[model samples]
Target chain A: MQTMVETRNLRKTYSRPDGSTIEAVKGVNLEIQQGEIFSLLGPNGAGKTTTISMISGLVEPTEGDATIGGFSITKQSMEAKRLMGFVPQEIALYPELSARQNLAFFGRMYGMGGKALRRRVDELLEFVDLADRQNDRIDTFSGGMKRRVNIAAGLLNSPPLVYMDEPTVGIDPQNRRRVLDTVKLLRDEHNMTVLYTTHLMEEAQELSDRVAIMDHGEIIAMGTQDELTQQVGEEDRLEFTIGAQEIAEAVFERIQGETPGVTRILFNPPEQLDEDSSVFAPALLTVFAKRGRTALPQILQELDSAGVEIQSVAVREPDLEAVFLALTGRALRD
Target chain B: MRSILTIILNDLQIFFSQRGNLPGLLVIPVLLTLVVGWSIGQIGGGGPTRLRVDLIDLDQSGMSAQLIEDLRAANDTLVLCPLDNDAEDFCRLDDEPLPLERAIERARTGRTSALIVIPAGYATALENFERVVIDYYSLSDPLQPGLVLQSLNAVLQRASTASMIPGVAGALLDNVISAAQLPPLEGETRDGFLRALYLRSQQLLTERPSPVSFRVADSDGSSGSVLDNGFSQSAPGMGSLYVMFTVLGGMSVLLRERRQWTLQRLMALPITRAQILGAKIGVYFTLGIVQYAIVFAVGAAVGMEFGSSPIAFLAVMAAFVLCITALTFALAPWIKSEGQANGLVLLLSLSLAPLGGAWWPLEIVPEFMQTIGHISPVAWAMDAFHDLILYNGGFRDVLPEVGVLLATAAVLFAVGIRGFRYE
Candidate 1:
């Protein structure tokens, strides 16, 4: 597989009033393959825009080098830029001009003209689902419609590599879904390589072929979903409250028998549930079913006979949000 | 290049699509021309002040009354308002010697153009060839002050000649002087001698005579059409004043293109940042030309003669527009907000027009102001236009103005290129 974009030890330092410097991007080394969708996930102020700007040739990196489609970002800027398209976090469109006109203008800047230019403009408008509103002025458009047009303009020249920074931000759910589906179509139909950045964990997981989790300007983890989760090992996280050592032992056996691949089970009691064997009551049966609750008198009777009286129950598993929390130690938005 | 054409098409589209902007851009210039044209005709080169004349007769005699009637018969250009007063009632807007102080004050305040005081026996003076010792008063602004004096002079000349005609003069001088040397003979020759003598002298002139003539012309004419003169000069100055609007509007392209992310997106494309800047500058320069054409049309419709040489006016206006266009591109990139651009445009427009002689003619302004006017492009443009229109100057007269404007445009273009940014 060919590397469409590669960053080698890229570092950016910003000086502060105290004469100290901030390392916004510290020695970031990455490679993205052609035709692959890559997502970079980070919270606010995590140097996302700065990194993207360097890659897109909008900002000059203080150190290291990036190559886009074999063109060096610093040394061959025009070529690098020519190979890529950028959609910024903020929606950028001319409010005074019609949507179609905006696309046509940008297309022409890339040396497009005549019938070819017109065809490209039409295709982009249709691609973004803005064909019907092509004649409407952007100022008259809804926020979502404007954003779609912004995306369409970015695609006017049909560059093979694309960078989208928070493309779904501030959009309604229906529009968001449409934009996401369109992105999928771009990848599936055009074989376009995309570098998608967002703080939304679910979106990143859904869209990215390879996810890179960055925090405080540093990528702490990067891999496929399974590969990254596997770093946490056989960790289908399990937990239950227990009132007695005897009941805890019995609950452990039940969990071991019910769920395959169950490796380690731990019994812990909350400070408030002390001396109550009923704490492991309902939870003991849940382990066997692996469901929140099984509405059955038989199960309840069995738990009572087994001396596992119900008080409280809780179970945990390793999902994307959990994995992210484990790595960053904070919520994605923060 | 292609981008330039696209940008022009975009501007034209917006201009046509947006009805509100069209009225101010196109309709107002036409309307200004029509309104100002009609008004100029009504005022007749003077602006808009009517003529007022006051006759103060101290001679309550029949001849003095006849003199007043002749004064009233002249024409509509002069409004003869008669004032009567005792010495005690002098300052009351009525009465005669017309109170020297009151009459002077009334003329100064524009209540009367001139006061005709029939001094004690001003009629008797005419009867004796002692001279009709009439007193006159007038203010300074009227270009027609001479007209006022001329009318009063005509009335007095007629009255004096009337008192001297036929037997009236012959009866008094009949015993003392010969009849062959006497001026003329007529019936009530006292009544019409003045009118006939004035008429006969008018007929013998080798030169075509104006309605009123004197040995020495009055330097101050009547204040007939003051605003007309002001508006003519003011309209051209407004050309300079409103040029800033184009500059402001041109600079708006930066924020607009930047906001649209067009700049950023363009940079990402195969093009250079310079290409984008070139396109915008090209577009706004075109806008500046459009603005100049509109203002020129307005000035022309108002009957402001730019000059016999159309090339000179076009060259000067083109140079000025280019300089402003370059200035717009240079300054626009540095300004971060639309409000700041607006404030700069307004401040520059207001201050530059006055300095450049748009508010009034530099001839009436002080020498120091005239020198200062050279600092603004508008000043150069006005000088060039003045040479062309007022002086009827040829292309050579406008060459220096064009040179300076071109230099300014070049400098601004260099500076603008230096300041441009892509994101």
Candidate 2:
């Protein structure tokens, strides 16, 4: 397989008004192959956007460079940009313009014009299932419809590479599922390379052929699902929901020492949960162990002896979330 | 180039698609031009209001009478006071004399717009081919001479030329006859010859058209004269004022585009940043031109003068619109929110429009205020338009104003394009 996109030590630093500087992306290196879905999976503010912005040529990198189809993004930006499509996280389309108009305009920007541009727009609109609403202003459409049109605009040039920066954000579950399927269709049917960025581990897990797990402006892990899950040594995850109360750290230490197969444990206090909910979320305690089901009762007894009220418990197989938790020592949502 | 045009067309389509932009772009500007033009026309009484001019002809000779008649013919709007003043009354020897002091006082008290005093040379000075000084008095400021005074000056110019030419020619003839050592003609022969020459010269002068004629047409297609109407002022005035309104409104639109990330998306395309910036500027500039065209079309329908130079008129419109569009871009990068941009647009348009004499002529303002008003680009544009519309001026007459507007636009575009925030 040929590499469709590559970045070498890409970095971006932003300067503040008071003269302080922040390194948003720290030496990101990526190689995406043709006809594959490569995911940059991280929580918000993990340099996913800055890295993507550099690769997409929307932002100037303070250091290093990226290439799309071997065309340097910083030097041969027009040629590189012509080889890819960009679907920004924002709706991006003019709200007052109809879907067809927006698509045609962007199509012209990519050097497509006349009947060819019109035909491409029509095909993309139909592909996005928005042919009926193609003439309606984007402002008049629902969020999902607008998102679909936004995605369609990116596909106007029929480029072999596309960058979708959290394309499923702020949409209903059904629409999100549809977007995921569309992303899959692009790779499976059209033989196009996709660089997908998302905060949701499930999305990355379902869509990505290879995932680069990012945190704090650095990619800490990159591998397939099985390769990443194996890094934590086949440890099952044991989760406990406890009523909101102060639990001593010594209790977790005691459980780790006494349990035979337990590897490590992490606790998410209730304060870290959503503030808007009327019902209080229970404090969570996650324990990684070989055969965590055998260690669950022991962990529960240890918590009960410490006067911790147990609300519920769940034991799960290792996944991306567990991989992130094992590597970062924090929950993916945290 | 094609991408730039596509962006402009795209923006125009978006602007027209929204119904809210119509009132600002077309309706209000047209209605304001009409209402303001008609209202100002009413202030000048619709037709040409006759100027009250008091004439004290101390000479009371046939020459002075001809001067007065010529003044009346020069401007039909001038109404000469004192219908029956002869040499006795003019020389202050009549039983009930209207003295020069009283005539001067009438002019001072605004009873007359100007007063003309032809001194008591009594025709002797012109007969001898000597210079004579006519004492002219009026309360009109020299800086802003009144219409009556202008008309008086015009008539006086013809009178001086008509009288002087004959006197000079007769003097030269006498000097030539004497210097040639010919026989010197006696009093009646010389007088008869000079009188014949004077009469014939006056006849020729009268036969010819007045050197300067005022042809005031009813430009509005109404019974009233065009001089009294304000369409010439209001068309460009309100047009420029609303051009600022419509173009400066781009600041908010630009901010919204940035916030919504459409600008970012455009940057992500295969186009250069300069192309995007040029296209954005072209969008607002084209809209500004369209706004001016709509207002001026209404003006044309209602009879407004576009002056002798159509190309200069277009240049003025283009330069002013470009300046305002540059202003929009220069300020757009600093605006934090749409509400701030909106408030700034209203504040700028309202303050700059009135300050630049968009609502009234700059001539009505004080000299210092006029100097200050030119700081607004609209003032330069209005100055150019006034030269074109009011003075029937050509391209050379408006070049200075156009140069100022273009220079200002260049400076502003430099700042705007330099500081423009693509993100």
Candidate 3:
């Protein structure tokens, strides 16, 4: 397959008002093949947006460069931008304008006009299942409806490459699922390359053909689901939620040694829910074991004997979340 | 270029689509033009009211008739009582001759505004180029001349100047002949030659049109008819004020666009940043011109004069609109919130509009205030409009005002384009 996008040591540094410098993207390198869905998965503030912005030519990189279809984004921006569509995280549309109007305008910006632009707008509206609401002002539509139109605007030019920066952000779950399916449809039916950025591990797991796991402006891992999970040694994650209480650190060590098949253990103490709230959230204990289901009862009994009050228990298979935790020593949601 | 036009069209469509914007863009401006125009007309001595000035020509000479004609020409508002008198048939020969004393009594009692008495021998005095004392009788105070007295004085000054020119020229001719040691001509022949020379000189002065002229209407001496000068001043004034209102309102819209990320999306397109900036600027500029057109259309409907040069009028409109558009863009980047942008728009428009003499003529203000008012672009635009509307001036007359506005626009555009926020 031909590479659709390639980055070389891409970096972005921001200068604070006080003259301090902070690196948002640190010497990142990436390659995405045509007709594949590539995901940049990370927590909030992990430089996902900055990277996408640089690639989309919305922002300039401090150092290095990115090329779309062998056209350097910074050097040949107009040519490179013509080949790709960018769907920003915000609605990024004129709310007073109808969806069809917005689509036609963006289509014209891409050099499409006349009946061709109109036809493309109609087709995209229908594809997004928003044809009935195409004539309504975007401000009058629901959040999910607006998001669909935003996605449709990106597809107006029929570009081979599209960059979607958290397209599912702030929408209902059903709409988010619909957007995911539409993303899949783009790759499956149109054979278009997609670069999707999200902080949700589940979304990246479900949609990406290949994933680059980023943390603190660095991509710590990149591989298929199996390849990434294998790095954590085939272990499953066993989680125990306990009532708010203090527990000795020795309890986790004792439980890990006594529970069969258990390889490692991590625990989190109770936390305050909010600034004004007096209630404390349940503490969590996560155990990594070769066979999580078999070891759950033993781990629960060991915690029970240690005088730990258990609230709930769950056994999770090794997935992106576990991969992220294993590599970064932090939960994906953290 | 096509992309820029498309962006401009899209922005305009969106702007017009909002029903809330229509009142500010169209209705209020038109309404204000009419209201303000009529109000100023009333303030300007009740809308072209004609002053009734009675004329009692005891001399009944051709010179006295000519003087009456000159007064009639000087001010349309001067209603010569005998020429326009109709109620009691007082000017008819069948009725008893209205005496000069009665006319003066009528003027003093305010039945007529003023009375001019041309005594006997007026024609002989004028023919011989001798000094003539023409009595001007009026109830108006000499310190504060009424419209009738002012018109009378203006015509008399021209007459006196014409009369003096012949005597001066004849004396100079006589001196020249005597200096050359030529024999002095006998009385009849010399007088005839001097008389012909004076007639020719008077004709030459009368043929040349006055550089300054007024366009007041002659009323029936009851009260003034509705004057168009009020609308003439109000149309451009209110139009410019509303232009500032409409164009500066773009600051808030632009901030909202940035917050919505539509501006960022445009930057990500194939179009260059310059194209997007130009398109945005074009949108507000077009709207400003449209706003002016609406107000001026109202002015036209109500009989307002657009001066002798329509193209210069359009230039003034264009320059002012461009300047305001630049101001909008220059301030848009520093606005942090839509609310702040809204407040700033109101503050700038309200303050600048009044400061620039949009509410009244700069001529009415103090010289120091007028100098300070020119700091506002609205003042420059209003000054150009006044030249076109009030002075009957052409393009050349308004070049300085237009140049000032255009230069200000250029400087503002430089700052706006340089500091523009593309992302």
Top TM-score: which candidate number? 2
What stretches of model 2 exceed 4 Å from their correct place?
A: A272-282, B45-125, B128-150, B153-223, B226-228
Which of 2 and 3 is the better model by DockQ? 3
For B200-239, candidate 1 gives per-residue lDDT tens digits of 4323321333334333222143433343343455455566
List TM-score per model, in order. 0.64, 0.80, 0.79
In model 3 chain B, where is the ten-residue run with the lowest total lDDT?
A: B88-97
Rank order (by DockQ, best first): 3, 2, 1
lDDT of each: 0.67, 0.84, 0.84
Fraction of true contacts reproduced, model 3?
Answer: 0.96
Candidate 3's iRMSD: 0.8
Cα lDDT tens digits for candidate 2, A1-334? 9999999999999999999999999999888999999999998999998899899999999999999999999999999999999999999999988899889889988888888988899899989999998888899998898889999988988999999999999999999989999999999999999999999999999999999999989999998888888887888998888877668999989999999999888888776346675665678888889988888888888988999988888898989998888888877777
TM-score of chain B of 1: 0.54
TM-score of chain B of 3: 0.64
Encode model 3's per-residue lDDT on A51-98: one tens digit a residue: 999999988999999999999999999999999989999999998888
**Candidate 1 Cα outliers beyond 4 Å, as residue runs:** A11-23, A233-316, A319-324, B28-235
Per-residue lDDT for A80 in model 3? 98
TM-score of predicted structure 1: 0.64
